[model samples]
Target: MKPGLFVAGFILLFGHCTSSLVPKKLTDADGLVIRTGTSAGMCVGYCVFDYVLNGTNLTLTQRPNSVQSNLTTKTCQSTISQSDLNDLLGTVDLATFFKQPAVLGCPDCADGGAEYVELQLGEQKHRVTFQYGQTIPGSEALVDKLRTHRVALNECK
Candidate 1:
């Protein structure tokens, strides 16, 4: 092979390989809460919730206004009952509790953006939003921590 052609091929291969290493941001809408950031890769799907914790028990209510779709302009409405919230709260730690925004991807739907979730906590009913994707390394560890917290709460009863 010609020296020039070999160099060109090497450059092309290097570019493709490096591109794969570059992380892409996953953005999604949670009703009025909108979050955007980069994730390790593309997201397949997600869910959003509004949660309130009382002692070791929690109530997670799905907010209809917190729905965002990347695949369709249409709005989606869903609810999470108080009993369901209690079950989820019992399983997770309320102090470290966080909500995830809905995520979707389709060629026919909108693409690109961060996923957001809004939560209302306590009697003050403080509202807060959380965005996922560009978090610290070890996504699994964070998830496990949350899961363990949930189990602890469940044991309280």
Candidate 2:
């Protein structure tokens, strides 16, 4: 066998075995709530975000700081497919997660956002709060993902 072919065959035969050796992902119930708040000028007080899923229904709401001197809240709702919901579930482990509060938050910094994250899986629930710019230990990846989801969910504007 040619050297390249030998190497290719070895990889093809063994590559599939590594997957089973990997640990199974932690799965949880199907609910998520992401509340984000920001503070800048007296004009822009805060921003709150919420996303909830029940079966095929997905509700997203964004209510910015009442600094506008207005009491109007914006909300958008959409129906999500089962496949999309499954994809969301595959993204994080609701179990053994959100056990610790985010670190280095509540700085007196100006023009920053705070995040209140809550996840529910079956009978399990975890909620954590931290500033957006601060580091969240043991959940940096999850925070980043939530930020991205925040942006995407923002399109409901």
Candidate 3:
């Protein structure tokens, strides 16, 4: 066999092996919420929001909201309404999320006008939308975050 041919075959085999060994971690959810902050040049802020799926309904608690204080490195707490809390724990299907219109001026180019996962929590259904093209990067991260939250919720139950 030619040396060049042998090298090409080995490269192809190695590439296939490496690709197959990479575990796909995105199959653990039905949908995800990708939240991205407005970007300025090299600096970018990103967050992942996930839905805690509790059977068919999600629970919303009236926890205190916090704000960072400039005087002290502590947070200030604020009260929230029950309605507002319920509105926050909703869940939805992954397909519907990918069908909604994208918000204008998304910081993450990956999330340019992509649909978001709509969740039905408690008695209300909330729409969790993401920027288009972000279904891969942001979406995946969002799914993982949601999964973590879901596990925590399960533990509480």
Candidate 4:
């Protein structure tokens, strides 16, 4: 075998072994949290937004895209009850995340911008990178809940 091949194989094997040493704490979390980032464009900078749903509280942050004249960033927040959070979770159990596709594939993205979704509960956390409106199955329910309460949230567009 070539000398370069031996070095490459050793590096790959070593990297994998080292990665296994890192513990996955998110998989053991007791509470549930969902974070999402949405953006459009083949590249970067185009109406970027982020959201975090923890316990009964919701927060939204947005930043203008490159095309936009305003460069300001905005943040908004709202709340939901623990029972309501339960209802949302009932629609989509946490385990479903384990079976989630690595990429949700945004069908609506004209040319495919970018979107990221992360779900955390206890020590289990799942993250997906997809396109706009193209998230995993069962996510719509949670999205709907957020939308229904969007009016109460600040800085979330």
- Candidate number with greatest lDDT: 4
Candidate 2 regions exceeding 4 Å error are 1-46, 54-56, 79-84, 102-104, 107-109, 155-157
Sort by lDDT, top down from the best: 4, 2, 3, 1
Worst 10 residues of 3 by lDDT: 68-77
Score each candidate by Cα lDDT. Answer: 0.32, 0.55, 0.37, 0.65
| lDDT of model number 2 | 0.55
For residues 1-157, could you state the per-residue lDDT of candidate 4 as single tens digits?
6999999999999989655533233221246677767676544433676778887778888877767664677887877887777776665545556577877655335776676767775566788777655556766675555445543553555
Decide which is better by lDDT, 1 or 2. Answer: 2
Residue-by-residue lDDT tens digits, candidate 1, 1-157: 6999999999999989655432132111111121111221234433323232333334333322223355322222233354543443343322332332223232212333232222233221212222333222223333333333333332211
Q: Which predicted model would earn the best TM-score?
A: 4
Q: lDDT of model 2 at residue 65?
A: 62
**lDDT of prediction 4:** 0.65
Reference-based TM-score of each model = 0.23, 0.57, 0.22, 0.59
lDDT of 3 by residue, 13-72 (tens): 998965543323322232322222212222222222223333334442221113312222
Each model's Cα RMSD:
17.6, 11.6, 13.7, 8.9
Over 4 Å off in model 3, which ranges? 23-25, 28-157
Clashes found in each candidate (C-alpha, N, C closer than 3 A): 15, 2, 18, 11
lDDT, candidate 1, equals 0.32
